[model samples]
Target: MTATARLALTATLCAFAAPALAQEITINSFGGAYEEAHRKCVIDPFTAETGAKVNIVTAYSADAFAQLRAQKDAPQYDVIHFSGGQEIVGASEGLLLPVTEEMVPSLADLYDFAKAGVANGEGPAYQIAAVGLVVAADKVPSEPTKWADLMKPEYAEHLVLTNITNGYGMIGLLMLNQIAGGSGDDIQPGLDAVSQLLDAGAVVVSTSPEIQAEFAQNDAWIAPYASDYAFTLKKAGLDVKFIQGEEGTPASFITANLVAGRDNVELASKFIDKSLSPDAQACFSEALRYTPTNSKTVLTDEVAADVVYGADAAKGLMRFDPRVIEANRSAWTEAFAKTIAR
Candidate 1:
């Protein structure tokens, strides 16, 4: 061949050998430490394995759901995480796609409780955060074993109660209501109990940061919060102890759902599947103290002790229906406000 012809042949071969661009998908993750752990545990490993790029949008559960509603015609996120049970409403309104075992093979490996919402056309829970009591070990006179213990007169003025607008706070309040003979349809009993506590001097906080501040600055002795937050408090040098109220620990299921109408549903499924893998689950458990949803995920004895590990342990967790919670949320919030105001 002539020199020019040979150069032309080399250029054609180079063009044929060029790599295709990596697939990219956008996902919304919670902010702060949870997102940091998610990056290390799920996103990094997913990229390393699949060669797909994940673009993150940091919005908490309620805000993310609102964004989904607003963008229904032009979906932005491929996958969205909800720690606040927004998936129920999202799935109902057709904002989210139904996740199945066929799409995400690891769905079969999740705990039964973790798969509770899949039949409702929602996503499977990737991790569990048990809502329980976190007490300042040095301040509380004794370790609280049940939800009613918070009502003890001695806890007055040193207790921090979360507002119902927050997910953790919502679960905490529902659990209190359950023990106080109030059902989801009837929150009056719960409100009355909270009013009694408020009358006795317990303070109400609306956000996690505020709760942390109450603990760090105000000598708050006890609070109804999640197990994972106990670790956060401990990391901040507070001597805290997590107690799963003997009545039952309410679970906060963190779910990752596919956004409806997204072009990258296949890629999004892979991302969600990666989160349910034993390795990723274990990473989340260690980093954020979130309980692994994947049944196969193994943990060290220390980590197991901290989370709600194993099938039997998971069976004992209290799971409120997200549908019921969403339905009653508005009226409950109003009643809560009125009660607290008194």
Candidate 2:
């Protein structure tokens, strides 16, 4: 061969022998313990099994949704996780793609409620956190049975009421409203109840960490919070016990969504599918005390005791429509502030 032709042939052969770059997908996760659990449960396992590189952006639900909106035309994250119901608005605004059985094979294995949002172009709920009461067992003489127990005069000064601004607080308020004869449209009864609690000296808080602080340092005897967080308090060395109200425990559904206008839709679908798998679901359940949404996820008796496991167990959980909450959220926030102020 001529010298120039020989050089061209050698370069072409080297190019052909090179391996393709690994597929990469960016995703958002809530920070702190939840992020740690997600890395161990879903992200690490997905990467190991699929050989895809996963990049994590640490942002909570509201911030994550805001980021999605800011990047709607050119999405940066392939998948986004929402603990609140921001997916409803995201899907409506064309920022998220619909989750279908065709996109994710594991969709068929999830509980009916978990798949309820699929028709609305929203993602399926991968995990559920039940909103109930957490009590300092050593401080309270007797166990409380329902949502109304927080109003007991004996436990008046020792209460921690979560504000509606928080996701868990919103669900907690809804549960309180339900038991107090208030519906999504009519929150007066719940407002009246909260006013009474405030008058009785209940301390209102806006975040999980504040609730934990109250239990640990401020001698808070009872608070309406999530089941997962109750375990968190326990792990922190507090004598806390989570109780499902007799009326019903309101639940927060954590969903994983595919970002619209992304180049890695197929890879994102695989990540979502992996999150819904039995092993991943079980890992999350064991690590965070979050209830698994996949029907096939099996938990040990010890872990199951803390979670709302199985279809029959999940059926008893109270679920408010995210659309209703989204619609009334602004007015409800204002009313909640005013109620607590009085």
Global fold similarity of model 1 (TM-score): 0.89
Model 2 lDDT tens row, 151-250: 8998888999999998888887887788889998898888888888889988999888899999989989999988899899888999988888888778
lDDT of 1 by residue, 83-193 (tens): 878888999899988888899999999988788778676888999999889999988777788999988999978989999988888888898888999997887888888
Please report, in order, the local distance difference test score of every candidate based on alpha carbons.
Answer: 0.88, 0.88
Which regions of candidate 2 deviate over 4 angstroms?
A: 1-22
Residue pairs clashing, model 1 = none
**Which residue runs of candidate 1 sit more than 4 Å off their true CA positions?**
1-22
- What TM-score does candidate 2 reach? 0.90
